[model samples]
Target chain A: MNAVIYALFIVLPYVSLVVLIGGSTYRVLRWATTPKGGGGLYLGLYRLVNRAGQRSYLSAVGHILARMLAFHTIPKNSYGRDYGTWLSVFLFHWGVFLLIAFHLHLWMPWLRVGAEAMYVMGMATGTIALGAGLFLLARRVGLRRIYGLALNALDDYVAITWVVLIIALGLAMRALAPPGLFGEAVAWATGLSSLHPEPPPAFPLFYAHVLAVELFMIYLPFSKMAHPFTFPVNPVLYGKFEDVDEVRRRVEEELGW
Target chain B: MVSVRKVTYGRGGRDILEESPMYGEWRREFEGRGSVHVRIKEETDEGTLKAIGVTEMQRIDRGASPAERKRFFASRVAEMARENRAFRHHMDACVHCGLCIDKCPEYLGTRDPTNSPVGRADLVRRIYRRLNKASDGLLGRDVDDKDLARFLEEVDLDRIWTYYYQCTECRRCSVYCPMGIDQGEITRAVRQIFVEMGMIPEFNARTIRGVYETGNNMYIKKEAAQNVLDFVLDDMRQETGRDFKAAMDAERADALLLPSSTDFFSNIGTLKGEIAIMDELGLDWTLDSRALEVANFGLFEDEAHLKYIGDNYVNAALRRGVKMVVFGECGHGWRAFKNYVAPRLEAMGVQAISITQLTAWALRKGRLRVDKKVDAVVTYHDPCNLARAGDLIEEPRFVLRSVVKELRERVHNREKTLCCGAGGGLLTDELMPLRVWAGWPSVYDSLRTGAQYMVAPCSIDKAQFPAVIQYHKAPIKFKGVSDFVYAAMYGLDVDKIA
Candidate 1:
């Protein structure tokens, strides 16, 4: 049991991390080297920069950041006034964001919080994330009969359900378990991140949560979950004005026109 | 309260209410391909493909063996995916969020998910993905003969031809897409792939051939074109009491104008308005009989054809020794000129400007004055090409405000404007059902505005919206921005314009 936990937690994570980094890098390289002919990504960037009037790479980047971070595209206009889905999406995204940020404490031992505070913060964020995940999953499953049959892939539902379980387990651990259970896991994480492998507590529910996350990380690069890494490839979000010129040159040169 | 559920065909004729498949399954076999039975190698009647310049619907297969056909299409898809970043990103970025499902006009009208932008894009995207996998051999996976056969079978040429044509390529879906995935780009890529397979649509091919043969889609001879211009100019003189000169192929002019061939016959008022503005501003502009078209149907087909057709206009302007080329009231023509041809034109030391920009400039500079504005309230329809593609949203509105008593904006105006459904060469009589359904959103929105006239800046809108009004029994009249501008300049009363 210890060896399995050790391998899954300490050893397998490194392998998953390698696959994530390497696989994503390969996809990115493939995108970069691919001889794109019409203005796809570049056209979007060109429009953005051209609209913003700066017409520079920095302006494109700044606009992309504002759009992505500030949720600039999510208002009634972009999402077609579907405020229900929009609210759920907003909650799910920001919930995941806060949850990811909170998990950074596992790697930094110095950033320890008091038991009561950790419990409170964990319950609050975990509940929000769990609730949002449940809402999204329910919406997907409920709409499957009406509109989902044409759009809902199995992976879509699985991704949502997987995250929901992870968050739910986390909330359970926060509310029911003794206060210091994560302290050992945090120490183990800190040690493992620093190249010294440490076995965490032998709690079955805790290990179940950890294993689910490991499976997710391992599956990330191969599935749509890798959208974050490839987000910059979307022309509308990441294109610049200069890209139009680049696209024209590429088409002319590559096609030998 | 339009019945949005009227559109019914789902995957493989399965009632969407009964049983539907996931998006992945939907792509492999969704046959919501309207009623058009396009068979490979079976020649369609020339009269049925009733479009300008087309003589016959070419046989799709052209005697290629199935293996050769499969290889040809597969290789093109592979090549496009390997080369085009926009194609790659759009194909790969779709997470099947289905956010674009409810927003599509075709989907809303037809209730077929396949008509939705994401659904339409998925048709090509799946093929692109399969091709990518075969090429990359990701995870040491090799594509076997059976896999290839399955792919070829699923991506049927007939289905591909039907679905690709059904889209308007409006990019409305992109505006609402969470990842900013422009399905239109993917549709363009897919259509390009089809064109490579030698399966040219009769309307697109014939129109393109006409442009190459006679320098315009209408195939009007230079003598006939000049005659039409002279007749319109004579009428303008009698109506306005001003000698507005319409020059043909002047050796050296301040600017060259390109108006849609349709403007010469049907929508002549807009052309007269253009002449009035040019005359008032004292700008020496010449309209060449050889390049007297602002509509480029090649934009709806393939890039090569677009360049081929676009070159004619550029050559016409250069031959005239004009310093600037101003596009008439045509949307897609402006798109082709600005996005595709403008760079090359700019490099050649000639400027390409839209009529809206030129008129707005004249108005701002106080070069052209309108003593009396038209009293009727008018609504402006932002042609998707001008608003989304060319960024001429405010310029047309500014000109409209200058000429009209009141400008009422539609519920979905500028950037988010609905297409008049005649775009992307889906203007044929055979596709009237699709057109009327897809046109519902815009027609509905226009009706909601309660304006007397729905004034669009594109010539296609001028031709398409009147039918929409007649079909719905709506009281609104369809006209152009230039038509009102002409009225503001010449008509004794606003009622005369109305």
Candidate 2:
């Protein structure tokens, strides 16, 4: 059971990463290649990043990081009429980030000391996220206007069920599993050089959690969630003036003001 | 008391009048209600006087001859259907919801459907469609001399001309248009056709011709332009005593300040503010009096005129060897300078920047600082020529917010802003009332915000808004952003800033 869990962790994430990265890259490239005019202010990525002076570089990076962490594609002002949808979005994103951070402890040897604390925090956040996902799914199924802008019933069902499966399995593994099964599995996985092989009992919940999380990761970049990365490409930033007075003066002087 | 008069005609062969209404009433009052006056003028050359009176009465219709009428209608229709894609698109896009009707100053004040831009465009389109179809079916031609005459007679040609030309093409109607139809384009096309037909209002014609010949619409001579600047600067010195020089053609300056010629003559406050802002920012800016006309009416005329006015700016900038040029509060002037003039300059290998863009840059660079606590509720009116038509909306707002305390934004701002109804060269005396009416809705909208002041960075709007405010009884001061900036920075010491 320990060997199998370790193998699944390594295999699932790699497959998910490959699909998400590849699909998003293709979509973005296709959009870029399409011809459309009147787009306003076309500067390369380097120039765009360098804009607002060098001192703003760190702030710009912070802004981008905040967006990714918080799923900040939808503006606060726009969510005035639909706060619940936005709140659910916020919780789900926070849960995903926390869960990923907790999973990093499993992979990184240096973070092994706080593994138990990380696991508890991750499970608690995951439970709230699962609830939020289920709420959003209900909204999508019941409310026509809200659903019009969001995922359809099938998509909502898949997303909510996946999150629920992961949270349920995570909580079950910690609370309902046999007393020594989980500890034995962890010890066997961590102790690579120890010749004493301690194989723990197989739990169906662990496999279900792994599969659901893997499916979610692979679906992320291709889903509406991809809008998070496109925040920087907003036209307002590009069209805003760098120097108003100089341009005005030059025009006046040229026009024989 | 009501007075009534009765006339009785005999039942005989010719039925000679027993008493006419006027004669009978006078006779009854004078002769005890029983007798009538049988008076006649003494033999005093009746035939000669009668012939002279008839000729005098016929003179009124002298200009409305068959040839003149045909020419007028043919030219009007041709003008309405000029080869302008912008005009065509706007006409085609109108949804005709009539929301724009009440928004029109002329339509509201006079209650005349003919004055509405949408109505005017529809009238022209209907006639064009009808004439085209009829001619195609019967005569294998669109318009003929007789058809033109009849069309003119049917559609009050003179009134249509006056009503259509009265529009400033400020694009107030475009804001309410669901399809975003720029009625200004149609108005412009109409104006162009009128010009082609030699039917332009005398004042506009003179101004257009003046700009064509003298390079400035007002036709202020080069020497006069310098003198006006000198006079203003001398006044500034007297007022503040700090050698406020209106420097012209300063070599190798970082920025070239371009105020409209009117700023030097009449609108000195705008100039003073521009100078103050530059001084506060510690910018290396200089003024050029020679190319100082920011109100480019040439854009309203043909392309040749546009090029001619644009060249003046380009030539002046190149001659001065300045790095950048700044414009005063003139919307179409800036529109021409930024959109048309700058491209022309670039094509002619002249490098110059837009004024609004330069101001935004200065703010970003910390060259200019606004206290941001000079508390006054201010809202910006985006000059139509600059905002929707010219792609300059945000810069002015950004600049205004930087300088003012409480900057209240109009609900429909930026690209969706209403026009001030003084664009497209309709700022003459004849069109003043219509101009005020055109600007009434926007003025009212600004008032609704409960703003203490409304700021527009367009010279035409600045000049016209005062009248609009007065007419609407709106208790708000209208000023340019530069005026506020100048007052804040320079205070009473205009000379030090200049």
Q: Highest TM-score among the candidates is held by which one? A: 1
Docking quality of model 2: it rates as: incorrect
In order, candidate lDDTs are 0.69, 0.55
User: Over all chains combined, what TM-score does candidate 1 have?
Assistant: 0.88
DockQ of all candidates, in order?
A: 0.26, 0.01
Candidate 1 per-residue lDDT, tens place, B10-77, comes to 22343221222222332332335422332222233444233422223222455788766766777677
State candidate 2's DockQ.
0.01
lDDT (Cα, tens digit) per residue for candidate 1, span A17-118: 887788778777776676546553232122321231225667767766665565555563621356677777777788888888988878776875886786
**Whole-model lDDT for model 2 versus the true structure?**
0.55
* lDDT string, candidate 2, A49-89, tens digits: 11122124355556456545654433222102234655786
| Alpha-carbon RMSD of each model | 7.1, 21.4
How does residue B223 of candidate 2 score in lDDT?
80
The Cα error of candidate 1 at residue A168, in Å, is 2.3
